[model samples]
Target: MTAASRQMKLGAFLWATGHHIAAWRHPKAYVTAGIDIDHYIQLARTAEAAKFDMVFCEDAAGLREANVAIASQTSRSIGFEPISLLSALAVQTSRIGLVSTASTSYNEPYGLARTFLSLDHLSGGRAGWNLVTSASPIEAANFGSTGLRPHADRYERAREFAEVVTGLWRGNPDGAPGHDGQSFSVRDPLDLPRSPQGAPVLVQAGASDVGRDLAARTADVVFTAAQTFEEAKAFYDDLKGRLAAYGREPDDIKIMPGVAPVVAETAAQAQEKYEELQELIPDDVGVALLSSYLSIADLWRYPIDGPLPELPPSEGMQSRQALVIEQSRRDNLSIRQLARHFAGARGHWRIVGTAAEIADELQARFEGGAADGFNVMPSFFPGELDAFATLVVPELQRRGLFRKDYEGRTLRDHLGLKRPM
Candidate 1:
């Protein structure tokens, strides 16, 4: 079927606290949930209840924080390893796609391939890989390195790594026994049978130029944070155009942006709920972190309400840093407001309204060629996500905007994506 023919796909981007920076601080969401396997289990089941295509988990290679960032930072660190957690979920939940992020910069390709291959087998093809070339400085030191890898260079390495991984999978047929044994080098392949999909679906999330090229070559799905119609359509057109160069079709890669919704019965209630959640952010900390991400020194150098600081020439984190600064400048957001906004990656796109209203925004993007689907990060999870599943999902189903029930068992099936051989 053509892109125009398929219904829009939906995947929930699950964080330990549930997307909002202070989600765990919420009254209903389990603050202790990040470390608990049951938290993810509940989340996966919730998503399946909504007929969402998958549940995606973002991972980082290095430790984020020891005490504060570590203890409270369920997202960047200190959660069950994604594949392991998802493996457990595979036994409990049947339909939702399980996506795990693994960085190409810090990991060995052979190891990652084997692990995800095992997950694919275990989940019966409900597995998807969210490929990331991590952009954190803190992660470098933990790996016995002092500096972050160059951005473009990371993508270059990722392209090669993907080639090797997929090549390893190329020999294995779906549900058939086979092995290359590059890591173990054992010619006999008897441990586990071949996975149902042959290989896990490849998903990538980077808007960088180098990132885009790698996605065109290796990814079955590409994720971005663009939310607006014009931006989404432009990216969709540009990416689809590039696929032919890789000897692939435009339909081969699907583009999705992140969406965070705060839904209530009334628009006023939704906005109020979002603001209430916003109040929990730490102002000074956000300013410091945001400034450092853009490589600016002393965010305290500027007033809380002052203009965003100009960043230095790009060393490695180029367009990414510029985007944040430029967004700050364009919106004229203060540090406090910015922090609250980033409570859920503020710039990604926030839908504040009733379920019908939120559905309208989603439909607009899909019809406008802005998205093949969305990476939904809820504002306050478990409860907020529960609201989404209970209230908003039916509205989407009413409009034929999302799945009323899962069509197929595997992640690829839910996305209307064919498994790549």
Candidate 2:
């Protein structure tokens, strides 16, 4: 597509309550959002009505926080399993794509491949999978593993897992000799037919060096986090640059960084709205969140007002750990300050502005080659999503930066992705 015709893709990243740690406390936020299928149905319909490319759900096998007290303080402890949730939504919403996170760490390839293909057919090709190597020790413990696998080992397993899943989705015949690998073994092809869209769109969010390589090899869409234009651009260029080696073109993969926008009619209102939520965050909750991202324990033991202590490499999310440390050092922020800042959007880029201002920043990133699109993360559910759909989406449409209407039925058609041969 030509530059002028290259409209940006948007995913409505639907998290429980909201992306903000303190979102459940917001008077307008839906406190029961995690269990309310009706709430998710409403959220999905809202995104579809706004012409978003998809409604994305993130999943974890276990509770997010190990500390029972900390876990109880947040709404994250309760939520529908993403696959079942998306399946119910498949029948509820007609056009928007339904994408959900699933981990290679805990699931087998054939079952996962079969499950997503079922969702694809159920949605009439409007399905996608965001692949992740489960990074949390809490998740590991739930699966009865001795401990968390090293990061490299997890990715190695993921690489093979993805290969098998894609192979099955691409029509590996039922009686064929199947995969025999280091981490898994498969005896037969999936019982289902090929996905209605050729295959369910493969999405990945790992941004480490190995992660980038994995994405280049397999992902049709990449969801990432970047706090700056420079960071986004560099990641975009590097990942796109790797396509050649994989015998794929740059256009084959869509790189969408996560963007959290707190938008209102006026800048002051937006800022006020943001600060209101930030003020609701208990310091301990924020610190626990920061500690999880850092892959460290007892971050609370440090002086909340003091500088971050030096750290070793993380066996968790390496890219996110680096991002946190970089921000802590770059801004000379104390633990309390950094935790509060990151707690709002969990380290994704945040924009507190009027509709037009938010559009300008998103336009800059898209037009400047820093991103192909964005995964829109609203601070709170319903209210914040409603605000963006009403205020920002129209502004984007008016500027011709986003689609005014759906051009086709399937997610692949909306994304202009090539069908598998």
Candidate 3:
């Protein structure tokens, strides 16, 4: 697509309170957001009104932090289950897509396929699934597993899991002899009709090599994290390049890296707003958050003022760990400094500026071939989401980088994705 014709796709990444680690502590933040259905309903309506492509939700099967003290200080431990939350939001909003993360690690193909397909019909085809392999041990323990599976083994299961789900979604009716794989055995087709937009959009956020390959094979949308233009571009090109091997074109998939933006009427105000949130993060909470992503439990053992220690590869979030390590070394940041930095945005690219400045950065990335779009991560809910909608979105619309109004009813049309046969 030509530059003028290609508009950036945006997903409102909805988290309770906000995406920042210290969001729930912000005075303006609604601390009770986790239990407030009206809060999410209002946020969804706001995104729909702003013509966002979708509102994405993340999920985990268990507690986010293992340490009770650390977990108590933050709001990550409390939130609505994403699928249930989105199902509720489906009836409340009419336009924006509702996408939720579900794990292949803990769910079977037949059940997962049926659930998302039902959601697609309920939302009039505005449903998506963000595929993830449950990487955290805390989640693993919940399912009575002996331990977390190795990274490669998890992805292998995911590969088979995705194939079965997609086949079921396509209405495969051969049930006499059904799929019998290493991890799953299925004997019947899904007891559901074909999806309204052919099938609910398939989304993935695996950035490791194996993860990227899985995404290229089946994902319609890929969410990623990158802190620099070079990193984002490299990932965008690599993933898009792998598509041809699967008999798919580059345009077949959308690559939208997560972007955490703190926007205000002025640059100084935006910075001030970000600093205010930053100051709310406690030292232990910051370190604990970093440790969880790094897949290590005793990060607190390291000297806070010292540089990051050499570490083994992470089986949890390999891509995220690598990103954190790169940043720490490149900037020569100490443990405390790195923790504070990543704790704010959770390892995604962060931009703090006025509406025009935020728009300028997004435009450069979109037009510079670094991204097909962005999954916008607001620092706090309601207020920050409102700021992006009222301030930055109009600036993007004026430059023709984003849609000013809904031109299509389903998420497929909004994303310009082809309706699968």
Candidate 4:
């Protein structure tokens, strides 16, 4: 299909409460949704009703924040394990895909493969794995490591781990298969038969150089955090370009950037909503969150309105650090200003507008060849998700930019992605 004709695939990136850092603090958002199965079921059904290609759940092996000070202040300390949550969500909704995040740094290939394979079967072929190399040092500690693994080493292990997982997914038709890889040695074949769509879709959300290469080589869907059209296009072009070298076609992988959009009846109302959420974030909380995200020196040391001093070197989240720094320099934002800015989408594109306006932004990106689609990160849950489904989705449908209804049963079918042999 041509770019304009290709339907924009949509995935609801469901975070606890919402994508905004202070989303839980919002009056309309349910603060305890992280542990509430009913809340997730409602969200899933809502997205399914809107014909979303998938409902994505992000995970971290350890507490996301650095310390009890930040962790206690933040609402992110609590959440369900992704695989278990998605497995339960599978029974609650049909047609809408269930995509869950897991870390290669902490999980073994065999266990991950088995769990996802079972989820695909349980969901009737609507499961996707968002493969991530755990970035937090806290995650490493949970796995008995003293510190974060080197970036290159982590991706190396990930490459091998993914290979083993896919190899196991392609279990022998006649005989058992064995895999001996640098990271894992699997002597026994997977006992599970292929699910309806053959295997769970492979999704990756890494933007660093090593991460991008890994995504190009293995990801069926690439989730990204692109802030601008130029950045998105650059990433899209770079990723699609790498597919040829891997003996993969351009269409083999889909790039879906994370976009957190706030929708309302009018432009003013949307801006008001966006600002309201931003205002809820305490300066200290926002700055701390920004510091952790960029993994640079604590910005609290610098004056809130003063020019950002030289960023300290970071061995953590290089691409994100660059993105944040570039944005700060480009906009000449103060420390407090950048904190509030990051609070909304945590560096993902945050669009505040009406339904038609949101649709316009999505269509522009899709038609501009900056994105195949987007993983929509609503600023707040239930409320924001409902608004998008009720307001924005129809506009997209009207413009023929999105599907009116699910055309097929499997996730691959929803995304128009080919099943692997």
Per-residue C-alpha lDDT of model 4 across residues 1-421, encoded as one tens digit per residue: 7755789999999998888888888999999998899999999999999999999999998888876776776789898888889889999998899999998988899999999999999999999999988778878888899987788888999999999888788777766557777787877887788878978899998898889899889999999988899999999999999999899999999899999899999999999998898889888888888888878546788898876677776778888889999999999999899988987888999899999998999999999989999999998888999999999999999999999988899999998888889
- Model 1, which residues run further than 4 Å from truth? 2-5, 65-77, 172-192, 292-297, 315-319
Better of 1 and 3 by TM-score: 3
Q: Tell me how many clashing residue pairs each candidate has.
A: 0, 0, 0, 0
lDDT of 1 by residue, 1-421 (tens): 7554567878888877767766766677777666788877888899988888888888876565433543343344566777788889988888888888988777866677778878888788888888888667767767888786677667777777777667666544443333333222223323445568756889998777777888888898887876457767878888888899999887778788888899999999998887777676666556655655565556667778766656567555565565676667768888656655654564577788999899999998888777888888887668888999999889988887776777687777777666665
Each prediction's Cα lDDT score?
Answer: 0.74, 0.94, 0.94, 0.89
Candidates ranked by lDDT, best first?
Answer: 2, 3, 4, 1
Write one digit per residue (lDDT tens) for candidate 3, span 369-402.
9999999999998899999999999999999998
Worst 10 residues of 4 by lDDT: 172-181
Order of candidates by TM-score, top first? 2, 3, 4, 1
CA deviation > 4 Å runs, candidate 3: 173-177
Work out the TM-score per prediction. 0.90, 0.99, 0.98, 0.98
What is candidate 2's lDDT per residue for 39-104, written digit by digit as tens?
999999999999999999999999999999999999999899999999999999999999999999
Candidate 1: worst 10 consecutive residues by lDDT?
A: 181-190
- Model 4 steric clash pairs: none
Judged by lDDT, which candidate is best? 2
